[model samples]
Target: MRIGEVLHMNGGNGDSSYANNSLLQQNVILMTKPITEEAITSLYSSLSNPKSISIADLGCSSGPNTLLAVSNLVKAVDNHRKKLRRRHSPEFQIYLNDLPTNDFNTIFQSLPKHRREIAGDGSGLCFFNGVPGSFYGRLFPTDSLHFVHSSYSLHWLSQVPKGIEENKGNICMAAYYDQFEQDFSTFLKCRSKELVKGGRMVLTMQGRPSQNPTCHLWELLALALNEIVAEGFAEEEKLNSFNVPLYTPSLAEAKLVVEKEGSFSIECLEASQIYWTGYNGSDDYEVNSGYGVARSVRAVAEPMLVSHFGEGIIDELFHKYTEMIVDSISTRPETTQFTNVIVSVIKM
Candidate 1:
């Protein structure tokens, strides 16, 4: 299936929604806040007494986490204005872009409250618009954006990578780095055209350790699905046909793509590890970690799973997945963590 046509986080504020289960992504947002602020600060410093700034958040899946990075960027700009003792903070025209299938209604629904809150703070005049489409191509007019931010996204290929005949039980796009590299280059090139000179893009993407391209969490999910198939819950043929259109590129690969793309200059690209549950020590790891992992995975992966395995298997499948996760955590806690690469780039 084409990922753009089907891939979306569970919508709304319901129990199974991405808004409910995005702790892992939320943690990534928190971790990358400093990088984002630094990028924004640099971008603003380059302008003399700027009065307005255009920002875009790409692949902004619908959830509480969706507004997070953008919120910080705005806050940073506001704080910077205070430090400068400027009479007026810059006007912000913020665009939240995602796939056409994304839950834009939910995003729009939350905006009124968000607007009220921001206005109460007296931060600045801000206008929000949801631009629904893939980011692999241009989504804005030339020189329309000043800064771009995306977190816990961009590892997703525009489609499943070609040149791999069989990943065979493994659903992730790890087996085809060449196609992934090309698509990433294309994505960067497209963004370059939309950004003004000296504009910046700060992105955080799911990634893997260069020593190991395979993230164990995804591998564990593949294991759980295979178990389901073994028990006749899912047909082998269906299993063979199913694949997630996502790839976790290594830091080296990501930098290489940027260099090869040749439109943007990489400022910083660093990888850090995060636990699957995003455990904060307030919760019981052994008791809640499995379910937390399951919820996060379910929120993101359910659309693809339902499309291929039918809606009936989702609950049961995630239940089995939770059990498998618990077992993996018990035996090898290290296996439950994955790396995220945060990249900050400047348009040349």
Candidate 2:
């Protein structure tokens, strides 16, 4: 699969689009927000404050969450500068990057409103641009970026792992864990070259619990796909050829990859669980949990599914997938846990 060419969140703010279905990713950003603030705070304190700061958000798909992260960072810097009694905070050159197919139009259209809300007076201190590319390789010039943030994105390999064709039943791509390790190391090396010395990065993505790397929400989707094949809704051959290019690494695995690359120092590593249907501090079960999961899944996975199975099967496939998720939630609510790994690294 040409992931950069085909993979993207659903475009626009339609009900099924990623703009509407990205609460999970939002929660991920929230989980890593404090770490990001700390990194940015340390960044300014460590160096003579430049007149401008360059920040790039990788895998910043079009959505509220994209600017939400940037806005928070800007606020953090502004607050920190005030506390330090600095004469002025630096202007920001913020880059929002994603696959070329991403819904950059939506991000661009929303920028005016976001700028107005964030900068109030429309000071234009923050310059925002959509950079269309993959983060697995070099996307910026050497020593150009002072800070980088990526959430819920690194899990997606540049392409499907090698030797993925051997798998027939489960499409988790766990068999190619080593492939993921190599790709992740390469990604870090590329970022290291782009970052200035002492620059920092905070990344949050799907991760596996060390005790049980086998557990994942994809298992349920695999089951649903198998059922579709059994019912002849999708061909067995097509199902066998299709595999999601996602890998949830354990914190240890992530650390090992960074260590092997020898460019970034691992400052912090954390593991947390986020429900597919995020808990809003409510005891009452959300009846719409299944639809929520289905929409989120569709936003990211629909392109791959359509390419492999044809667009005709999408609605029916997700309908059955949603039903299965609802039934599982009713019977085994614990299975809804989605592990998130957050890592903060500094370029050495």
Candidate 3:
């Protein structure tokens, strides 16, 4: 499948849109906030307080999370400037990037309010541009960016891997480690060229604890799809041919690719876990229920599913998927968390 053409989060602020259902991703952004802020602050100090800063947020899908991330980064820099007692905050040139089909218009429309919020904080003068494209290749001019940030996006391959057609009944490309290495190395090479010397990048994405790629949620999804096929709601052939263009690497795999790429020095790499329900503290049934988790997944996965499986089966698929998830969670509530990898790197 042409992932670039088909891959996008459901757009707009509707009930099922990514904008409304992205609390899980928003929680991730919040979870990794300290690591991201520290990277930006260290880069700024290394640059001896430049008057202007350019930052690119790759795979910046639409929603409050997109601007939520930007707001945090800007706030970090603004706060640091105050700490240094600088006379003026640096001007910010922010590039928000995603696939060509992403909801750029929604993000654009929300910018007026975003601008006002930043101004209200007495932050720096901000300039925003929407860059629509894939991050697997070069998307910025050479030596133009000072910092780069991506969240929950690098796990997607540029395209489906070759020779996985026989791997039926599975939706994730978990067995294909080589494809992720190639894609991730290319990502590093491109970003190395785009970032100026001493530039830094902070990336966060789903990861596995070991070389094993047995993602629990995806397994649940596959089971749901298979059930749909058995019920004659969809074709078995279509299910066999379909696979999610995703690969969640282990920390060792990520470090190996970076070392082999030889373009950036790994400043920090760590793993953390977040519940599927996105609850940080005490769990709320409304947020932690199977329905809530299914909604979040549908918001992110529906566009791609409709592209391949036809729209008629989506509602039934998720509905079945939700019931399966509820059963699974009741049996093994401890396995409901997703492992996340956060890495910070500096151009060598």
Candidate 4:
């Protein structure tokens, strides 16, 4: 996807919920819904019992997802407070953070009026604070946050890996993997300082350690683009400009990096593989529901598709791509697969 398109996809906000909100109800909710609750309950016991608490949701794109995630955190904190036997709930400074280019307009407009409705009375004190630039850099005051949460967001790197743009051999392609490691470590270091001692964090991101992070996902993306290229669709140059920043980390790699970030104990690790079965098994979601996800993968395919296929067969290829998904799901596996890792850690 072009930078402009990516900006449009990431920043814009609307009702992108899948049919019946199945994405939330069937899969994403099962994996990420409770980490916030588990982390908050465990974290509250370790804290010094402060009256005002701070928390943030990193990479919180503009949409209902952000609100739902925030709601998850709020519910967790509220449940924990009850155990504290405190009638006066602490002030919660919750920051909904994401890239500056993100559509704050949509996010701000869509924010819920009653954050506490599901969890009951609590002064959420919600705030819209853009990370402004990048997650690899500082976005808040020192030791300012009590808890940090990010979901299906951190797996994306700051930008596409270098040299992959040039289409060099695997040598250059490896840049994506190297970059993911560097960025993740940098993120930890940056986040470490912002968190108070014992601050807690929950993150859910897509990954596949068994496959080469540098190649597999991009290869799949490339294959998808190839079809578009063969049939002629978008411009090839635009595709070349896009890149995904994240690399799926192996279990060992994830543990090593967090351990290096000073003192952090990995609390929970789970595998969540998912299939993007759009409403009624159709691909029209590219224009609506899948917009954000589609934009995220654009860099992986656009340039190759356009450059290879030119402009004649774009639509034809997309049709083939869509059908393939349905066909694959209907076959034997029953559903397509995506491997995800959910990690919870505490800074000591």
Model 2, residue 323: what's the lDDT?
A: 85
Looking at model 3, residue 94 earns an lDDT score of 96
TM-score of candidate 1 to 2 decimals: 0.96
Which is the better candidate, 1 or 3, if ranked by TM-score? 3
Instruction: For residue 327, give model 1's deviation from the true position in Å.
Output: 1.0
Clashes of each: 0, 0, 0, 14
lDDT of 4 by residue, 139-178 (tens): 8889999888887666666666655664521211445667
lDDT of 1 by residue, 70-138 (tens): 888888988887887877888899999999999999898888887876767677888999899888888
Clashing pairs in 3: none
- Of the two candidates 1 and 2, the one with more favorable TM-score, higher being better, is 1
Give the TM-score of each candidate.
0.96, 0.95, 0.97, 0.78
Q: Candidate 3 on 245-348: residue-level lDDT in tens?
A: 88898898899999999999999999999888854344645335788889999998998889889999999999888888888777888888889988999998
What root-mean-square deviation over C-alphas does model 1 reach? 1.5
Q: How accurate is candidate 2 locally (lDDT)?
A: 0.84
lDDT (Cα atoms) of all candidates against the true structure:
0.85, 0.84, 0.90, 0.60
Candidate 3 TM-score over all chains jointly: 0.97
After TM-score superposition, the amount by which residue 347's alpha carbon in candidate 2 deviates from its true location, in angstroms, is: 0.9
Lowest-scoring 10 consecutive residues by lDDT in candidate 1?
278-287
Model 1 error, position 126 (Å): 0.8
RMSD of 3: 1.6
